[model samples]
Target: MNPPFDRLLADVLACRHCEALLPEAPRPVLQCHPDARLLIAGQAPGRKAHAAGKPFADASGDRLRDWLGLDEETFYNPRRVATLPMGFCYPGSGRAGDLPPRPECAPRWRAALLDALPAVRMTLVIGQYALRWHLPGSGSVSEAVGNWRAYWPRPAPLPHPSPRNQLWLRRHPWFETDLLPALRAEVARLMEDPAA
Candidate 1:
């Protein structure tokens, strides 16, 4: 973390705007740096990630790492890869799964965080919420991801890597056959670039 990011991070961690409504106390989980070339814009933290105080600390993260063809070291390295969720804290669970990210998080904090990391070459927009935010009017996540080529060099929209999405994955073989490989290649290129 650079000086400005360090300060912003402190503020983010200290945030409690939704404390009264939150099931658990806020523990904003994220990784960032002044020199990150790639950003993973995911949904809110899950139970495990919230407990761990780290983004992508669960099975979903493991799958995402595989998709990017990245080892833990490279993926967790803040200078190379950054993880910023639409909602920084866990939004608690619902009947089906985790609830949507808190409505206030993105509007309050996203711009500041993005500004702190000026070297972001590309953002991996993961899950429905992030896709909606990054590629507005692009329709559902499936449609946005199916036409991922349209958003290249700026953002790459992807589905959530949670185990719950197994059915979607099974239905969309192209995601594995075509998109994953392309995503890996791009990630490699960006991560390998010294200038980035």
Candidate 2:
């Protein structure tokens, strides 16, 4: 992170545009670097991640890493992977699950943050909010994901890796049977490429 990028990131970290709607003091959790090759664009921090001040530090992260065939060292490496959720802080829980990321968060910050990462080669969009942002009007998560190849080697849509989605995974057997292997291969290639 250079001085300019550092300042940009600092601004993002200090964001509180939706502070009133969050579950706690805004503890924006994310990872970024100018050299990052893969971008993990997600909805927001889960309660566990908000507590840790780290993105994707829960069981859902475990499954996401498995899907990408990434070890923690590689996944957590800011130089290699960057994580920027729609909302940086935890939005609180609801009867269905975690609330949708605070609607105002991304519009205010995403573009500038994205501009800081010049080396991004691929993006893994997780859950509905991310899809809506990254691939608007692309249809449901399943539909966008089913059309993943069209975006090929970048911007792959994925269901949230929460255990709650076990049924979704079971229902969409082709995701594991097809997409995971391809995604893993690209991940390995990016991790190995020196320029990336």
Candidate 3:
């Protein structure tokens, strides 16, 4: 059966509501199959990803793959996992990090996207913005990510895999000890059986 999500995704890719506000306009990059079991919801693309028109094609991607125990090929495979962002385009950068994702993309597209991925068993919400949107009212990023056990079988908040956050990782050794193993195991299990 052709899942309803295909149509929803088509609509998302066609979206241009905030084009004028964008520095390079919205490109809405994402990858998924209707039957995907794992969902990776991130913040907007960095300059690299926006330019390349691929999701997670930078240093952050390397760390994300490491955390998930996936190679580039497996991470980009749509049948096993989906990579959708809070915003579709590069929202530029701030003094500390990249700017927040454009507001329109998620409000306009996220529900439809989530509705379409009915088989998704785990959602890795990367970065503060993604965690805020996916797990709203969950307090600060540290709070939400720290309480990873609560969002089991649905969404799991993760710190951004960017090298910029290396200091944060060093401070929080428990994340490596506590979360990475479980996250990797779940991802591996899903990749092994997309239907699971």
Residues 1-196, model 2: lDDT tens digits: 2999999888888888778777799988999999999999998899999998888999999999999889999889999999999988999999999998888989888999898888999999999999888889989998988898987666889888999999999998999999999999988889898665
Candidate 3, residues 40-153, lDDT tens digits: the string is 999989999988888998999988999999998878888777999989888888798788899888878888778788788899888777877788998887888889899975
lDDT of 3 at 157: 91
Measured against the true structure, the TM-scores of the candidates, in listed sequence, are: 0.96, 0.97, 0.93
The worst-scoring run of ten residues by lDDT in candidate 1 lies at 1-10
Task: Output the worst ten-in-a-row residue range by lDDT, candidate 2.
Answer: 14-23
Clashing pairs in 2: none
Error of 3 at 39 (Å): 0.3
lDDT for 102 in candidate 2 is 87
Candidate 3 collision pairs: none
> Which candidate ranks first by lDDT, i.e. highest?
1
Q: Candidate 1 lDDT, tens digit per residue, 2-35?
A: 6777889889989998887788998998999888
